[model samples]
Target chain A: MKVAVVGAGSIGLLYAIRTQEAGHEVTLFVRREQQIELICNKGIQVEGESMMYDIHVKNIMDISGAFDLIIIATKQTHVKKIVELVKVNEIVAPLLFLQNGMGHIEDIHEIINPTAIGIIEHGARKLSDRTVAHTGVGVTRIAAVTMKQEDLIIYKQMLESSHFPYKLENDWFEVMSDKLIINAVINPLTSIFKVVNGEVVNNPNLFRIAKKLCEEACDALGKASVEYHLDRVKKVAMQTKDNHSSMLEDIKNGRRTEIEGISGYLLKRANDELPYTTFVYEGVQAMQQMDRREYE
Target chain B: MKVAVVGAGSIGLLYAIRTQEAGHEVTLFVRREQQIELICNKGIQVEGESMMYDIHVKNIMDISGAFDLIIIATKQTHVKKIVELVKVNEIVAPLLFLQNGMGHIEDIHEIINPTAIGIIEHGARKLSDRTVAHTGVGVTRIAAVTMKQEDLIIYKQMLESSHFPYKLENDWFEVMSDKLIINAVINPLTSIFKVVNGEVVNNPNLFRIAKKLCEEACDALGKASVEYHLDRVKKVAMQTKDNHSSMLEDIKNGRRTEIEGISGYLLKRANDELPYTTFVYEGVQAMQQMDRREYE
Candidate 1:
């Protein structure tokens, strides 16, 4: 399988390395001149607690090529631009979005063929543009929105052989909903509070806010509610005690956050009567606005 | 008139200088050894927008004579200590509390003769210890819980001669209630948001919170209500748009805030039905606790 890892961020780099280690030809599509140079010069270095690997890398926009799978692992705010870059470059493949937050599926469907699969790839950002540590081996579920079986099966075989946990779910909405719950619960709070994920455990106020926000999102989605979202959210915050959320990463790096696509979105999507959740969302939004003003 | 200004902070220095300029002998009480040495050697320099004056200063515990008016201008947390110092020094006159908030009256009453007057002196903090800009020429209202005619006349004459727009109110409780309303509305919000008194006008959410808190406080006092307390609170926030609240000053200086003395007192004093205000109080307390843990 020929895999093109678009954006070439920590997540993209990790995926490229795993796929290449499984004997698949992996190509890294990166925009920044420095990232391309570094990856090409040093290859992709992925160091986890127990595993380490280096894989092939390249600048996809510069090179002329097509691949079996194209993973969109850039920040959510960069999704539209990456999509435009892909469309303008005329690179066609089954694109996988591994960014945090929800509602990127519609954007992908609009830009490219509806042959994209969204994956909630959870790990840790070891550092900025340097190394990515696979903190925990979590199951990655993938499903075809508008793709056929042959392509799906071929990609599944490659993913399974890569030694990274991967699963297939026809109900990708459920998976996406689950991921949204976790991200909404952890990302904004950890980012806004400027604390590690685990600090939410001792901070009762933060824990309550996280749980309430998650329930709000679940209520907005109108799906079969899972009673365990709160526990799962708490567990994730506790498990990743030392790690900052992706939003916090953006804040630390002085980049735009995906707050609009997460809590901001939930507030707009949720009904007007949900004042408790909406109040929390609005408060988070105000804090985000403050950050934006401070940075600008 | 003989006057002693307790707590040689910016406000204390201002009162001492103005009293001295009005031809009264004024003594500023210092707490710390360094403050005492600094003030005694260099004099308390009251640098305002218009003029600068060096005030004659003395330590509170070092004073050997009584004063006609003792103005306490320390942060609310230091009130009890100042009262104790005043009691030990045997300076028994009308000790007017020049800080905002509603809890100091009881504390001062318990420690001193019931003749201590509660003052609501509002203005601005323009700089550090050396300077204070008088933004508004507001009246320094003094009401004696219990006082002889000689003491009352002396206190009133001292304030009037000092060019301070002051008046004596028969109902001290009403005057204190009005100031409490203002402080309950403005202090926590300005401190928590880290905004100036005026910036709350631009942030409607803050304005709403401030108004709601003030209304809750007014209801708690059960006073002859004025429609303008809300307007006055909003006007003050806008008027001192660039100035930090005393509570914010405490936070910035890493001093323990008067949370328990100000908004905390209002919340504790209000009936159980005003849970919304209680919620705001708890929120402020939570932030204060977090700040203590973070800063300390």
Candidate 2:
């Protein structure tokens, strides 16, 4: 199987390496020419292991070949642009988007490719352009947005290994909301507090705040299964205890956060004002501009 | 007039130094005996001024001599215990408590000494045991919690000078509520985000969070004048632009914060749940216990 990953982020790097290790031909398409050079030179360094894996790399602009599957591993903020790039490149391969929020995913019914959305339970942190640490090893769950669920099984098989498993969810909305609520609860908090993912649940006071975020996400997204979502959030938080949330890493590294897609999306979707979500959305936003004195 | 400030904190040191400079006999009472030795050896250092003022200092445990006025410049958490010490010492001086929130100020009516509560608009940060930088120079407003407002004038005169001035407010509830709402808005955000006071208003994104906090505070405290309070918050934030909030300084210095008095008190006072307040209250509380990974 020849797989093309659309972004050279932590998630993209992880998937590209793992799939390539499973004896599948994997090509990682990065936005920058410099990144391709970096990857081609340094190969892909995985944490806790000495050998850097040599994976194929290409500029996203020069995406020239057909592949078995295309994984959009960019942030939720980049979904529309990536999809537009996909359409222009005339690549009609089955597309799997691994993003945080349900941003632009539901609206992509008009896209050319057979699209699917995935919720990656694993945590990966990119140390550099060509290095990614697979911090937490968990299964990736995929649901077909435009593709049939039966057709997704083969793509899942192509990506899964003995260590990296893949599961299929029946409903795209259900699966995405489950991931969204958890991301909404944990990501902003870990970023704002500079705590690890598990601190959201393990720290009792932090857990109380995380519960409020979960409640707001549940209410605003119109999820009736509150109890189940809350339990799932707790479980994932505990599972990824040591992983610094991507948003937290972004803030720490001075990168633009995907708040607009995550909590900000929930704020726009809700009928009523989600105070807790808004607080965190604004909290993270404020933190971006924080400590730099505007006047004297 | 002989003035004794019961807490040798920033506020206490500022008041003691200023009163002594105003040609009033001033004695600062401190908790730690080491603080007295530090002050006795080094005198008191104020920011922006080089000359060290020789202010008298004594341990809080000994309240032997008589004084014309006693100012309780301790934290809101230490109010009750400080008031008890006043009773135990039997030094019947006109008492004035300078602190944040309405924590135990109203309850001090049972005390024998004529008591007044003051809202110190000036910002001060304790740099060391006996040194405080006067960050903002706003007038202190005194209102009688148990004593008559007419009777507070002489004590105010004793503390006021050309540089340090005090004002008398007819209604303590209104003035204190004004301060409480502002503190509730500014303190937690600055502490959480680690920003100075001005950024709460100067930074537009931060101002949004500040507005939500202010709105929730006004609603929780039953203040119908929303627009007025919001304006006051903005004004105070801009006025203290360069000053780090006391709570922010405390958090940075790894000291205990007074979240319980400000947002915690408002949470208990409100009939309905204050999500914004709870989020920030738990935010500060969680931050206190944060980053200390519990398991693994």
Candidate 3:
């Protein structure tokens, strides 16, 4: 299969290496000249629990052949642009978005036909530019859009044979909602408290606050069958004890965070009525202030 | 008149300078060897708005002369020990306390007799051991507990000629309550928000939250016939717009703050009944966490 990974972020590079290692030709779609130089010079290095390798890297404009699949691992804020660029450049393959938050896949589906799928797979960023330490050996759930069977089967086969576990679900909204609740709890609490993923376990008040936020997310989404979001948050936090949430990393790096995409999205969806979500929103704003002061 | 200033902190130093300028024999009581050395070597240099002067300084333990007036400007948390030291080692005069919040004067009164008067004055620090800067020229209000007519007349005359303004109040509770309201709004907000004093003016939400806390302080202390607490806060904040507030200075210097003496006092007095006070208590607690992270 011909796979093109967009954004060329750490997550994007990891996908490129894994897809290439699965006997597929992978091309990375990076925008910056410096990133293109670095990746093209060094190739894409994938460091996981058991293996490490580098794949041949390519820029989006330099690609020659059409891809059978385009996996977008960009941030939620950049999803619209990647979708537009791939559409304008005329690569009509099945695109799999594996980013945080919910409802963004609806935005993608509004632009294109029912070929895009949302994948919820756990991945960890181990370093700045070199590798993604794939810590969790979990199943990746890929849900096809509008009952697209052909795209679903091929993507599932590719993800499965790519040395990682994968699953296929016809109901994409369920997976998206579940992932959204998980993020609503974990991201904002860790970012606000400025703690590692594991510290929530020891701090009972903070853990209750995290659970309150998850309950708000669940109520806003109106999901009845979802598991308790706080339990999932604690389980995942225990699993990735040393990892800093990506939001916290953005704060430390003096970058604009995906708070707008995660907690801020829930705020917008609920029309700014949820108190817990608003608390998280205010906290992220404070984190932004702290970040600004750090660099200045 | 002979006066002794205990603690040698910024507030103590300012009071000592002004009292000495009023032609009273002033003796500053210091603790640290370095502080005693600097004061003895270079004298106590007080740089104010329109005046700079150096005066005599002395250690509390070596003091032999009797004083007609004693001013205690140590932190409120240590008021008991500070007063006990003064009582056990030296003669007790008409003591004046210029600390933050509401309890130190009463605590000292519990230890000694009701011979002490509480004063609320505006003063600030420039450095730890170098010079004390009187940022704002403000009157010191002293409420007498028990005083002779001759001593009151002389003390009033002394303060009047001192350069800094002076006022005498018959109601000690009112003056202390006014300062408590100022601290309720200024101290916790500046500490929690971790912003400069002027930032509260720009953020109305923060100002509103601060006003709620001021109301809580006013309600807890049933000293009647005063104007609204938040109005007093606005008046003081407007007066001291450029002042770096003692809480902000404590955070900058990594000192254990008087948050306990001010907000913590009101919060404990609230008896867990008022939700507004409880909210302010939690908010202040959260700010303490932020302060610890920033300082520690």
Candidate 4:
């Protein structure tokens, strides 16, 4: 199967390399010419505790070709731009979006192709332009946004391997919200405190704040009857203890964060009822702004 | 006039030296004998923009003998301990309590003698054990907490000078609350962001959070309707932009913050209705804990 992964970030690079390694024709769509040139010349490097390999794949600057599967592996903030690019280029394929929050779910409706959403439980970090550190491996859950089940089977079968596991779910909202709750609790707390995920639980005061944020998030999502548990959030934090959350990474790199999609989305849904959520959301936003200024 | 200033922190040293400079005999009551020895031998150095001078005021480890004016220039966290010392020592004098929050206001009730509360607007930094840098000079507002008008007049006359200006107010609660609202907004934000006070206003997102916090605080203090403006808070931040807030300084130095007296006090008074206040309060508490652990 031929696949094109948009955005050459950590997640995008990881998927692009892994999919190519699984005997599929993969092309990485990157923004910077330097990144494209670097990847094309040196290939992609994947380093981890158990695995270390490099895979050479075609890199592109234009979304001009049709593929069997199109993975939108950009941050949620860039999803809209990807959608616009795909629409203008008329690249019709089975679209799968791997983003961190629920805000991009609505944007999926704009895509006319069969669309699917994915949550990457694995932790991957970009070491350089063409290098990604596969920090941890976990099951990737994929669900249909507007895609037919029969259409997803081939893509799933093509992408899934013993090393790269994939699970399919019928309810994408639950998958996104479950991940949203976890991100909402861990991301901002770690970013605000400038600590690793583990510190949020190891530090008693931070643990309490995390618990309170989890409860507030759960209460806000209660109106939708979204299935969530504070324990599940804690469990995720514990599992990713040493990992810097994506939000924290964004702040460190002076990049815009997915806070608008995660906490900001929750704040919007909360509609003035979740005061704690509002406070955390605004506080993280302020920190992000400060981070950007420091880089400037 | 004979005055005894407790605590050898920046505020205590500033007041003690300034009072002595005004021709009044002042004694500094310090906890450690080292601080007393350092002050007694080196004297208290006041470094300012235009002038720098050292004044020798007797330092004592024990609180003995009656003082015409007793100024408690300790952090709010130490007020309870100071109150106990005063009670055990049975020193009956016109007591002036200089603290940052409203928590100590209730503790003032335990003192039987004439009591007054003060908010020091000046930005003073402790350069060393026997040295203080008067960063900025502002008016110190002194209000009678449980003191007679005539007694406050004499005490104010004794303490006021060209360098150390003092203003008298009828209500201490208003003065403390006014400062409380400012500290509640500025201190925690600066500490959390690890920025000087000016960043809280210069950064748009931080400024927004500051305004929101101020509004929430005003809402929480509904009955008294404390006279506070967000602009006043911003002005203070701008003026103290180069100086780390006392809370930030405390966090940086690995000392316990007066958060319990500022945001913690407001959180208690808010009665769980102020969710934003609770969130900010708990978030800062967690950061403080994290900071302490790093030093440990």
Candidate 5:
């Protein structure tokens, strides 16, 4: 199976390395020339609990060759860019998107391919240009957004391994909506408070705010199944207490956040039903804008 | 005239010294034995424009004898404590409350005496036990919460001076509400961002948040007169950009913030109408709690 992981971020790199380790040809589609050069010269470093090996994989700036799978591992903010690249290259392989929020699902609908949505539970951080720290090992849940049986079997063959497990689900909406509730609650609160995931749970007041946000997200999404999202959010926070959410890392690194996709998306769907969600969405947006201005 | 300034904080000390300089017998009623000893031995140091002097004034731990005017210059959190002290001491004089938020106005109503509310525009910071830096000189607005003509004349005589101007207003609610909106916008935003007052205006996103908060505050208070509060807030932020707000200073010093009096008060009145105010109010409250826990 030929697999290409778009976006050189931690998640992208993690999937590319793990897929290659599972006995498949993997190519990393990265935007930076420096990252491409570094990865090509020194290979890629995967450090942490799941793996600790440097593997060589093909790295490219353009989407040239056809592959069995093209994982869109970029942020939801960059999903449109990846879509543009895919359209320009006219690659028709199965497209699997691993993004934080539900906003990119609309964009994925427009792509002309056997599309799938993925929720990557693994906690990974990019250490350097060609190094990734797989902080935690969790299952990746993938579902057919618009899938074919042949494409699904190919993805399962390439993604499943003893160390990196991939579960196929029937309903992508349910999977992504659950993931959205979790991210919508944890990401903005941690980013605004500038605390680690654990602190959001450790501090009682912060935990209350997080719970309120989770409840608001559940209500906004109208998902009765995720009514207990507050507990799930706390569990995740405790499980990854030392880890900073991707949004917090983005703000810290002076990068554009996926707040527009997460909280901003919820705020738009909420209309006026969730005031707390709207307030938090606006606050995080302002913080992101301020951070971008400071970086510039 | 005998004037007593309770609570040996920056504002208390400033008013005490200024009254003394205006030829009134002034006494500072403080809580700490150390502050009493420091002030008795070395006097209070007032630094900044309009005056820089080491003036001698009587400092005592207990409320001794009767005073012509009693200025309650403590933080709003301590207003109830001061009220208790007044009840215990059975001191009967014209009481003047100088604190943030309108919550203290109800607390002042409990006191059985001629009372007035003051909005101190002077930006003062306590540098040491016996030193205060009067950072900026702005006119102090005084209005009768419950007062008599004789008491007002006495307060004017003691507090009004060429260096320290005191303007008396007929409507204390309007005066305090205006000041409340200003503090509600500036204090919490500055403390949460951990920035000086000026950055609240300099950052466009922060300024937008400030504007939104001002509008919410105006709506919550039902004050169409202050619809232009956004401009007022920006002007105040620009004027005091170099200085940290009292709330920001409190958070930095690990002291209890006046958030309960300002944003908390607004949140209570906003009920369900002002979601942004409630969100910011909760966030600042959590930060205060975190700071307290860390200090402990």
Candidate 6:
């Protein structure tokens, strides 16, 4: 089986290495030409693992050939661009999106392929252009977005391996919302406060704010889901205690964040006032707009 | 005129030094016995001044004598405690309160003393126990909280000098609200973003949030006050660009912030929903709850 992972980020790199370990040919798609040079030359180094895998990597714009599975692991902000460039034989290939937030769910209709929305519970971090870390081990859960049960099974069997496990959910909306709630709570709070993921729930002050965010997010979903979402938020935060959230890393490195897709998306979906959501949405946006190093 | 300035903080030290420079007998009432010891032993060293004044400094608990003027230079959070401890001859010693926010305004009625609320525009930082740096020069504006105009004039003349000046406003409510609005926009934003006072407006990202905060603050005030308040926010932010806001300084040192008096006060007075105010209020509150140094 051939797997095409359309991102060279933490998740993309992790999946590319893991899928190859499962005896599949994995091609890692990256946005930058520099990442291509570095990855092809140095191969890829995964933390805690002694060996480096000399995996094949290419620019997303130069992607070609048939893939048994295509995983869109880019930040939700870049999903649209990936779809525009990498829409090759979508009818035959099963499209799986592992991007954070619910923004790409809207764009799933653009591909005529069998699509599945996946939530990567595994904690992964891109240490550098050619290095990655599997910070926390968790299963990948995918739900059929447009794929039928039979088609889903074929791709699931090909994608899931012993070390790189996968779980399929019946309801795509439910699983994605669960992930969305978790991301909405953890990402921006960690980003704004400049703390590791664990502190969001571990610190009492942050927990207070995190709970408020959870409640705001669950408002649209109704109160029934509040406890469940809040519990997941706390659990995931602690599970990835030391890892800097992707959004926090973005802010720290002066890159654009996924606030637009996470908190921003939730803000737009809620019918009533989402003061907490709106505050963080604008807060993260404000962070994206300024480079504090100049002041320093 | 003999003057008593309580609290050894930036404002307290500034006023104590300036009052002495005006040829007034000044006693600095500090909370810590250590501060009293330090100030009395080595005296205060103010930035840009060559001579160190061996000024009279005493513990706040040891406060005595009927001073001609009593100024509460403590934080708004400490006003109640100061009022509780130093309930000196309020009627005779015209008490002028120089603290940020309107939280202390409510406690003024508990005293029979002629009280005036003042907004200090001077950018002062206590570099050490007894040393302070006057980073920016601005006037002190006072409005009578309980005192009559005639009594305010006496203290204004006694306290104001060539280096330190004072202005009087007719309506204390308006001036205090204007200051509160400025504080609400500047304090928490600077504190949360960990930027200096000027970055709140000078940084485009922060300026966006600052504008929203000013609008939410002026919501109950109506549209007439929006531009005026925003212009003031920007002007003050730029004027004090090099200076860290008191709230920012408090957070940095792990000291208690006056968020309760500043953003917290405005939040309570607001009639409509203030997303920006509530966000910052809770954000600063959360900051108070957690010490990130443990995680560090």
Clashing pairs in 4: none
Chain A TM-score for candidate 4 is 0.91
Give one digit per residue, the lDDT tens place, for model 1 in B1-296.
Answer: 77778776667767777777777888777777776666566565444445555666766668657666777878788887777766786666776777777677777767545364556464645355555666666677877666664566566775675347667777777777777777776776666555666655666655555655667787777744546788777776777676677776765566677667666777677674453355445445545546344321
TM-score of 5: 0.92
Q: Which pairs clash inside model 1? A: A198-A241, B197-B237, B198-B237, B198-B238
The deviation in Å at residue B14 for candidate 2 is 2.2
Which candidate has the top score in DockQ? 4
Q: What's model 2's lDDT at B236?
A: 84
Better model by DockQ, 3 or 4?
4
Error of 1 at A104 (Å): 2.7
Candidate scoring better on TM-score of 4 and 5: 4
* TM-score of candidate 6 on Cα atoms, chains taken together: 0.90
Q: Determine which window of 10 residues in candidate 5 chain B has minimal summed lDDT.
A: B52-61
Q: Score residue B237 of candidate 2 by CA lDDT.
A: 85
List model 5 lDDT by residue over A22-141, tens digit each: 987887888777777777777776874445434444444457787888888888888887887778888888888998898887788888888988898888888887788888889999
Model 3 lDDT per residue over A1-296, tens place? 87778766767866677677777877777777777777666665656345544555666566445678778878887877766776677666767888888636656776554455555465656464645666555566878765477768867776666457678776777777777887777777777556777765545545656666777787777766435666777788787766788787877776777777777777777733576676566656665754244111
Residue A71: error of model 2 in Å? 2.0
lDDT of candidate 1 vs native?
0.66
List model 1 lDDT by residue over A1-296, tens digit each.
Answer: 77777766667767777777787877777777887677666665667434444555566557447677777777787787777777887877777777666656667777655464656555755455647776666666787766775677667777775358677777666777777878777876666555677766667766655656676678877744556777778777777776777777766666667876776666666764443344434444445445333211
Candidate 5 vs candidate 6: which has greater lDDT?
6
Mark the 10 consecutive residues where model 4 chain A has the least summed lDDT.
A52-61
Give the Å shift of residue A5 in candidate 2.
2.0
What would the per-residue lDDT of candidate 2 be over residues A32-88, giving only the tens digit for each residue?
A: 889999889889878887877888898887876688888888888888887777778
> Which of the CAPRI classes, incorrect, acceptable, medium or high, describes model 4?
medium
Per-model DockQ against the true two-chain complex: 0.15, 0.53, 0.14, 0.55, 0.42, 0.47
TM-score of each model, in listed order: 0.75, 0.92, 0.76, 0.93, 0.92, 0.90
